[model samples]
Target: MNRRRTSRSASAEELLSTLQHLTARAREEVGLHQARVELAQALQRKMLPADLPAFPGVRTAARYAPARDGLDIGGDWYDGFLLPDGALGLAIGDVQGHDVEAAAFMGQIRIAMRAVASTVADPGEVLSRTNDLILSMDSSLFATCSFFRFDPVTRELSGARAGHVAGVWATSDGRSGITSDAGGLPLGIQSGQSYPVTRRTLDVDGAFVLLTDGVIEGPSLSIGDGLEEVRRLVSAHAGASAEELADRVLRAAGLTGHEDDAAVLVLRNEIPSREAASPDGG
Candidate 1:
């Protein structure tokens, strides 16, 4: 009986030891995953602009958030800057995947777009040149991109998109919807592809919302459903300022448990007074 008790005691000890080892291993794996997420988030933040460019009669805001649990590097980016021709240049894009290669490709495409836009004024030409550059990169990566150049003085906003969602414009006057022709073949798919420039006039106190798909999509939601949700959110918060509107959209998206990263850019055409919206106040 003494020998039997000894053997059972040794077996119990071994079982406890095995359980402790497994628990420690799990903790280690979690720590490693957390470290990678932090690193990826840091890299994403560094690549995307922290704040939108501001000028007289023009207000802009952007939000970029990387998911907290992913082994892949975030491949979403948004950029807003003043072009050399005095137009506000805005860009948002999503690379094909979320790996490090995708992130690197995003950066290169962004830089190339900015450089090309600075020299070319038309949105189609800018996108056409950007697509050419991507094809030349010799990678299998593709991206959905949108670019808009807004002339605050003229209130004319012109831009082109390549397989991206439409830019949403909302106003206090109940005029709101997605821009027309908001998509094309994804960049890097075909060289010499033409991206048509869609032009629209933004009356004062109006807003334009541009974002990557992650801003609206969900695990169970279809793209159409996600996009409608965005339009609804924008309409629901139509009266807010540019900065406030950006925050409201994000809060409304409720992306806490979102599987992918999201980036949003909001642009508002502002004026000193309502009469400034037109050449004559009559």
Candidate 2:
């Protein structure tokens, strides 16, 4: 009987020890993940523009949301900057995966994309250059991105997509459409694949909605349902300011429990009535 008791005690001790070791390891992993998330968030915040450019004839608003709950920052981002010819560069991209490494890679790709965008005159060329840069990087990672150069004065929005999510364009007449093409593979997947450049002339007071796949890839809903919800929200809030529209879209996405990193960029036409608004003679 004494031997049996001893054996049981030894077995319990061994099990306890193993449990403690596993607990410790898990704690360490959690800490490491937290650190990685912090680092990634900092890098992403730094890469994205703190303030939208003060350009004439256009109003812009951007919003980014991490997952509902977690320390994992995803690779979803947006960028807005002024081009040489008084045009506004509006872009949104999602690196193929979500995590610290993806976010870091996104930062690098973003800078390279901006540089390529600056040198290229057309928005399509900008995306082509950006895609090349992504393909040249380490072959393991992939990403999806979209690029656009919007001329507020002319109401022309020209852009391209590299396997990114479809874009939303809500026209002044209350009709809405999606801009998605089939050819371009996700950036970083293959070399020499090209994204077709598409252009749309904005009607009076038009708006564009750009987002990450995360917006549609939530746990509680399908992509089509999420999109329809977004469409409803945007339609309800159509006349609101750019910032308000962004807030509304993000709020709707969040309320729906989107479990992935998400971002939205709302570009609206706020053209001036008089020609004097554009000093550069556009």
Candidate 3:
């Protein structure tokens, strides 16, 4: 009886020890993962712009959504700046992978694109330069980007796309139009590939919403479904400011089970009549 009791006690002790060890290992893994996620978030914030520039003649608003759990920050990014010709430069791009490396590459490409645009007024030329730069980068990396130059004075918008997801342009009356082509290759994939530049005139009261694949690619929603959701939301709140539009759209999308970082920027052309404001640039 004494021997049996001793054996039972030993077995219990061994099981307890194994459980403690396993618990410690699991905690270590969780800590490591948390550290990695924090590092990635920090890096992403550092690489992307915290605020866009204010142009004298443009009304712009932007939104960026990192994954809900602080997962990897994808290449979904937007750029807004003033061109030399007093037009607004709008850009959105997605680097191929949703990892730290892709985010870093996106940073480099975005900076290069801004540099190119500063010197080149043509939207197509700026994207072509970006494509060339990306091709010289790592052969395994690829990116899709769209660039647009909007002249508020003329209401003319010139755009170029390098295989990015299409953007939606909505009128104040709930009508929407898709504004991208489907043939251009992503940057870093080919050296000589050229992105086609598309030009159109925005109605004095129209707004454009540009987004990344993360916004549409989810297990629960198809691209068409996502687009319709966006359309309905924008149409319902067509009179709201760009910033308001962005916030409402994000809320509508919700954060439940979202596996990818999402971002969007809304550009609205609200050119008040000459009688609406002072001539000294209000």
Query: Would you estimate the TM-scores of all the predictions?
Result: 0.84, 0.86, 0.87
Off by over 4 Å in 2: 1-18, 180-183, 274-282
Model-by-model lDDT, in order? 0.80, 0.78, 0.77
Candidate 1 on 153-203: residue-level lDDT in tens? 888989899998766778877777876775578788999888888888776
Across 1-282, the per-residue lDDT of candidate 3 in tens digits comes to: 999999999999999999999999999999988787776677678877777665444567878788754555676788888778778888888887676777778888888898999898878888888889767765588888888888867888888888887887777766776654544777887777767778888755767888877776677787677777787777777678888987876665552346777778788767556653666766
> Ranking under lDDT, best-scoring first?
1, 2, 3
**What's model 2's overall lDDT?**
0.78
Error of 2 at 90 (Å): 1.1
Q: In candidate 2, residue 108 scores what lDDT? A: 81
Q: Candidate 1, which ten residues in sequence have the lowest lDDT sum?
A: 65-74
In model 1, the Cα lDDT at residue 235 comes to: 77
Better by TM-score, candidate 3 or 2: 3
Question: In lDDT terms, how accurate is model 3?
Answer: 0.77
Poorest 10 consecutive residues of model 2 by lDDT? 174-183
lDDT of 2 by residue, 1-282 (tens): 999999999999999999999999999999988887888788778878888875565789999987645556888889998887778888888876667788888888888888887788686678777778867776577878888888767778888888887877665567766666543777787677767788878756667888887776577877777777777677666667889988888777765567788899998776557675688977
Per-model C-alpha RMSD: 3.4, 4.0, 3.5
TM-score ranking from best to worst?
3, 2, 1
Using lDDT as the measure, name the better of candidate 1 and candidate 3. Answer: 1
